[model samples]
Target: MSGEEGAVATETPLAALGETMDLMTALQLVLKKSLAHGGLARGLHEGAKVIEKHAAQLCVLAEDCDQPDYVKLVKGLCADHNVNLLTVPSAKTLGEWAGLCKIDSEGKARKVVGCSCVVVKDFGEETEGLHVVQQHIKSH
Candidate 1:
């Protein structure tokens, strides 16, 4: 193959692998993996503390959070600490992804409760999903 064609062939696999998962799906994978690895700090207060300490790798906020000040505080902290920030549409969905809510036998959240924020401290050995999430964050 020609030089240009060889480069394109090698790049194609990487591009495909990166695009295989959407942002939300990759985010969920990261949260789930982080949960088992004890890398997550659930709730706004805990998340803020993590960010303040510069121990956070990523911070996720729920778009439907009731407290605007808390969101702003976390945003500022993330910026100050150079941590990546992401937002999901619903707190309930975020709670589920963060494993804050208990799952029922029927595969549903036991309560209507939700967590507004989560701080990711470590991605553990499974860094692919985290890498994907960080790439998405950087691109936007």
Candidate 2:
């Protein structure tokens, strides 16, 4: 029994350019624990919806072949919507998110480079980032 190879190979590319990896990674911890404590299917479904709402492109990285069945559902949505999804640098979701966040120089917001996968077009260095985040959230 091995982990899903495909899932472990893809790292969140946004992680390198932004700050939301921390939030994403932390959610993995909560989700995994929830699953272990009897919250896998229902809880994961709810969380996945929230993440999907927030994330413009949802990347579902697999830890191994034994990846949870629930994640498969999320991946199906991603496929249907044509959202860019990747699976690599895998771990229990949160572990991987933390891993990516550590590398994100801009992984913060609210004067801290907040972590959301939204960006302003044609904006320069003088842009108000929080506003950008708000707009990004609104657009989706």
Candidate 3:
């Protein structure tokens, strides 16, 4: 994928943006693992609600989220709750990895353009992958 809006490719677009590519790859891996561990919350509303209740352990805000306020809310909530926040360069990619993929009636993959988060209720095996994500967030 070229990381351009409206691109139909489903491949990870990690080759064109130097350090950003690295960040995207690392986040993508974490999202995949988090999904497998059933610790993900997909979409802006869901993420915000989770954060509002102080349930999220780590949050991934796509850099291209459709709603700017979504980003602000997530950031402030994360700060207030001491949850880690990381940014993925593309919302589409983040959505796909977080199991939010959908196909339109026209048979095209719909873009995931909102915020996604990892909600952990307790510190257990489900949060094992969060350590890697936290390391990446600190470096960025």
Tell me how candidate 2 scores on lDDT. Answer: 0.39
Q: Tell me the RMSD of model 2 versus the true structure.
A: 16.1
lDDT for model 3? 0.64
Instruction: List, residue by residue over 10-111, the lDDT tens digit for candidate 1.
Output: 747745775567789889988988898999999877888888888998899999998889888988898889998899999989988988777887667776
How should the candidates be ordered by TM-score, best one leading?
Answer: 1, 3, 2
Number of the predicted model whose TM-score against the real structure is largest: 1
Candidate 3 lDDT tens digits, 1-140: 35564454433343333433345555566676667667677765677777788777777777876677767777888888888777767766766777666779885557654444444333334332445556676787
Give the 10-residue window scoring lowest on summed lDDT in candidate 1: 11-20
Which candidate would rank higher by lDDT, 2 or 3? 3
TM-score of 3: 0.61
Residue 62, model 3: Cα distance from true site in angstroms: 0.8
1 against 3, candidate with superior TM-score: 1
**Deviating ranges (above 4 Å) for candidate 3:** 1-21, 102-131
Q: lDDT at 6 for candidate 1?
A: 77
TM-score for each candidate, following the candidate numbering? 0.80, 0.31, 0.61
Return the clash pairs for model 3, or none.
none
TM-score of candidate 2 on Cα atoms, chains taken together: 0.31
As a whole number from 0 to 100, the lDDT of residue 71 in candidate 2 is 58
* Residue 15 lDDT (model 2): 34
User: lDDT (CA) for every model shown?
Assistant: 0.85, 0.39, 0.64
Considering lDDT, which of the candidate structures 1 and 2 is the better prediction for this target? 1
Model 1: residues >4 Å from true position, as ranges?
1-19
